[model samples]
Target: MELDHLLRDAVRRLADAGIPSPRADAELLASWVLGLSRGELALKALTGLEVSGADAERISDLVAERCRRVPLQHLTGSAPFRSLELRVGPGVFIPRPETESVVEAVLGQLRRLGEEGIRRPRIVDLGTGSGAIAAAVAAEFPAAEVHAVELSAEAVAWARMNFEVLPDHAAQVTLHHGDLRRSPELLGELSGTFDVVVSNPPYIPADMVPTEVEVREHDPQMALYGGGEGGLELPFAVVAAAEELLRPGGWFIMEHAELQAGPIAEHCAAQPLLESVHTHRDLTGRDRATSAVLARAQRGDVAKWRA
Candidate 1:
C-alpha cells in the first residue's frame, strides 16, 4: 500500500480503538518505519509514496499492536523527549511530553542560578526511568553535573542505552543502581551537594488503576504506583531525598499527578529545609510539576529501600 492509504487505514483503526491523536500516531509510525521525519513523510505522502511489501507488512503489525493500546514508543523502540529520542520498551516508564515542560522549568531555574554566578551546577534525578530527565539535563545544560538513580535492572538497562546517545556531558552524569527510598544510605557520599534535584517518580496510588492500557499493563508496576496513601509515599520520600541532597538554597522540581498539586506543595513547603513551594502547570493547564527551594540542611525521613 501507498503511504497515504496505509496511514489513513491505520488512523481509522487506531481511532476506532479510542486511541488519542490517531493521525499523529499513525504518521509517527510511518515515519519510524521509513526512518523519515514526520514532515518528510508528509511531503512524500503528498506524492503518494509507495511502501515496499516487506515494510508494509511490518507497519501493519505495528499498527495492529498500537490499536491494542500498546505505546507507540514501545512499537518504535524509542520515545522523543526534549530534542532526544530515547530508547524505550517494557520495564521502563516511557517519557511523556508533559515532562518536557518540567525540564523547561529546570532550565529556567538553571538560568536563574546562572545569573547568581552558579556554573556547572550539580544535579541529581531520583528514580530516573529510561534516564530521560537526567540525560536531557546533561545534554541541554552543558556544564551541569548530573547523577541518576534507579532501582530496576531492566529500567536501568534502558536508561543506560538512552544515556549513551546523549550528545554531550553524558560522561559528567552518573547512573547509580539503587533505590530512592534508601537515599540516605545510597546517596550519602553526595549528600547536600546538588544544586538541582529533580524526579518524575511513580506517583499513582496502588488502588487507583490507570485508564490507559499502555500504562496499566505494559509499564512496570514499580514505575507506576507510589507506595501507600494515594501514591504520596514515594513522592514524599523524593522530597526528603531532595532535601538531603540539595545544598542550602538549591532547587527541587518534581512531576506528579494534577491532583497532587495541593498535597505536594503543602508537604514540601512544610519541610524545614524546603521553601517557596510552587506548583507548575503543563501545556494542558494541569498542575503537573511542583518546584521548591531547599532552604537549609536538615535530617528528615528515613525508610527501607524496597525498590
Candidate 2:
C-alpha cells in the first residue's frame, strides 16, 4: 500500500478506536517508524508511500498499540520536556506537558534569584520521578548541584537511566532512593545547604486514581496516589523536608493539582521558616506550582537522617 494511504488508514483506525488526536498520533508514530522528523516525513511523503518489509510490519504493530490506548511516549520510550528528551517506560511517571510549566516556573524563580547575585546554587528535587525536573534544572544551571530523590526502586532505576542520557553536568546529578515523607540519610549530608528545593510529588486524590485510565493502567500507583483524603500529605512532608534542606533565603518550589493552590499557600504560610509563599499558573493559567522563600531557621531543627 502507498505510505500516505497507510498512514491515513492508521489514523482512521486510531480515531475509530477513540484515540484523541489520532492524526497527530499517526504522524508521530509514522515518524518514529521511519526514523524521521515530522518535517522530514512531509518532505518525503512521496518516498514514504513505498514503505515495505520490516518497516511496514513495525509500523503496523505500533499503530495497533496506539489503537489500544497505550501512551505514545510509552511506545516511543521517550517524552520531550523543556527542550530535553527524557527516557520514559513502564514503572515511571511519564513527563507531561503540564509539568513543563512547573520546570519553567522553577527556572524563572532561579533567574530572578540570579539577578540578585545568587550564583552556583544548590538544588534538590523530591520525588523526582524520572528525574525530569532535576535533569532539566541541572542542564539549565550547569554550575548548580542537583540532587533527585525517589522512593520507588523502579522509579529510581528509571531516573538513573534518564540521568545517564543527559549531558555531562546532568550526569553529575545525584539520584537517591528514599521516601519524601521520611527523611533520607543523604539529605542529612547537605542539611540547610540547598538554594532551591523542587518537587512534583504525587498529589492525585486516592479516590480519583481509578478513574483515569491512562494513570490507573499505566502509571505506578505510588507515584500518583496521595493517600486517603489526598489533602497534601506528600506535599506537606516535602515542604517540611525543604524547610530543613534549604539554606537561609533559599527557595522551595512544588507542583500540585490546580485546585491545591489555596491549601498549599496556607500550608506555607503556617511555616514560620518560610515566607513569600506564592502560587504560579501553568500555560493554561491554572494554578499548578507553588514556591516560597525561606525566611528564618528554627532552633533544635535537627536534620533527621534515614537509611
Candidate 3:
C-alpha cells in the first residue's frame, strides 16, 4: 500500500468511528509508526512512499485501538504541551490544548512582572498531572523555582518519567506526591511564598460521565471529577489553596469547565487574597481559565470569607 492512500483509509476508519479531527489523528498515528513527526509524515506521504507490510500492519492495529477510543497520546506515549512532550498513559490525565492557556496566563503575568523587575518568580502547580505545567513553567523561565503536587502514585510515576526525560526543565521543579487539598510536609511551611499558583484540577462533576470512552474508561477517575455538585468543590479548594500559597500581589491561574466559569470567577473574587478576577477564553472562545491577583499590604487576611 502507498503511504498517502493508507493514510486516507485510516482517516476514513477513524472518522467512521466518530473520532474528532480524524485526519490529524490518522496522520499522527501514521507518523508514529513511520518514525516521523506529523509534518514529516505529511511531506513524506505526498512523495508516495511505499508502506512496508510490517509498518502497514502496525498502523492498522494502532488505528483499530484508536477506534476503540484509547487516547492517541497513550498510544504515542506522549502528549505535546507548549514546547514539551509529556509522557502519558493509563494513570495520567493527558494535558489538553485548552490547559495551555492556563499556563500562558501564568507566563504572561511573569512577563509583566519582569517589567517590574520581579524575575525568578516562585511557582507551584497543584494537581500537577504528568508534570506538564510545572515542566513548561520551568523550561520557559529558567530562573523560576517551581514545585508540583500530585496524589496518585501511578500519575506521579508518569510525571517522574517526563521529568527524567526533561531534566533541564525539571531541574527547577520540585515534585511532591501528595493530595492538593492537604499541604504536604514536603512544602515545609511554605505558605504565602509562591509568586504564582496554578492548576488544571479535576473539575468535572463526579456524577457526570464524559462522552468519550477514552476519558470515561481510560483516564483515572480521581483525575476526572470533583466532589459534590456542579464540580465546584475541588475548584473551590484550589482557589483557597492558591489564596494561601501565593504571596501578596501574586497571581493564581486555573482551568475549569466552561459552564462553571462564572462560579469559579466568583469564588476567586470572593477570596480576600485574590482580587481582579479575570476570565480567559480558550482557542475555541470558551471561558476556560481564570486569573486573580492577590491583594497588596493594605488588605487584611481574607481567609475567613463567608461568600
Candidate 4:
C-alpha cells in the first residue's frame, strides 16, 4: 500500500476510535516501525514510498492497540519529557507535558543557586515514578547532584532502567526505592542538605476517575491515586518531606491538580520555615504547581546545625 494512503487510513481509524491527535499518533507509530524520524517519514510519504509488507503489518498491529486505548507511549516504548525520552509501559506512569513546567521551576531555582556560588547543588525527586524529573535535571544541569525515590517497586524498576540507559549525565542519577513520605528517614544523612527538592506525586482524588481511556485503564493504580480527602494526603506528605530534605535557603516545588493551588499554597505559606510561597501556572495557564524557598538560616540556627 502507498504510505500516504496507509497513513490517511490509520488516521481515520484512530480518529474514529476517539483517539486524540490521530494524525500525529499515526505518523509516530509509522516512524517507530520504519526506524525513521517523524520528519523523515513525512518526507517519504510525500515521495510516494510504499509500505513494505512486514512493516505494514507491524504498523497495523500497533494501530489496533492504539484503537484499544493503549497509551501511545506504551506502544512506542518511550515518552518525551523536557530533553529526555523516558521508557514507560504498563507498570510506570507516563510523563505528561504539564509536568515539564514543574521541572522548569526546579531548573530555575538551580540557576539562581549557581549565581549565588552554589556550584554543585544537590536535588532529590520524591515519588520519581519513571525518573523523568530527576533525569531531566541531571541531563540539563549536569553540575547538580540528582536523586530519586519511588515507593512502588514496579515503578522503581522502570525508573532504574531509564536512569541506566540514559547518557552519562542522566546516569549520575541515584535511584532509591522508598515512599516519599518517609523521605527524611529514607534519605538519612542527606536530610537537611538538598538545594532543591521536587516532585510530581500522585494527587488524583479518590472519588475522581480519569476520563482518558489510556489513563483510566492502562496506568498503574499506585501511580495514580493519592488516597484521603481531595487526594492531598501524598501531596501534603511530599511538602513535609521537602521541608525535611531542603537545606536552609533551598527551594522546593511540586505539581498537582489545578484545584490544589489554593490549598497547597496556603499550606506552604503557613510554614514558618518556608517563604516566598507561590503558585505557578503551566503552559495551559492552569494552576499546575506550587513553589517556595526554605528560609535562610539565622545566626543561632546555623550554630545549632553545626552542633
The local distance difference test score of each candidate is 0.87, 0.82, 0.86, 0.90
Error of 1 at 102 (Å): 1.2
RMSD of 1: 3.7
| Per-residue alpha-carbon lDDT of candidate 4 for residues 230-287, written as tens digits (9 for 90 to 100) | 9999999988888888888888999999998999999998877789998999998999
lDDT of 4 at 181: 82
Candidate 2 structure quality by residue, lDDT tens digits, 181-273? 655356776877788899998888866645546668999888887754655788888898888788778898899998889989998998777
Per-prediction CA RMSD (Å): 3.7, 2.9, 2.5, 2.3
How do the residues 18-70 of candidate 1 rate in per-residue lDDT, one tens digit apiece?
99899999998888889999999999999999999988888888989999888
lDDT, candidate 2, at 242: 88
Highest TM-score against the true fold, candidate:
4
**Candidate 2 deviant stretches above 4 angstroms:** 46-48, 297-307
Which candidate achieves the best lDDT against the true structure? 4
In model 3, the runs with Cα more than 4 Å from the true position are 167-170, 184-186, 298-307
Worst 10 residues of 4 by lDDT: 298-307
| TM-score of structure candidate 3 | 0.91
RMSD of candidate 3 to true structure, Å: 2.5
Error of 3 at 115 (Å): 2.2
lDDT of 3 at 258: 91
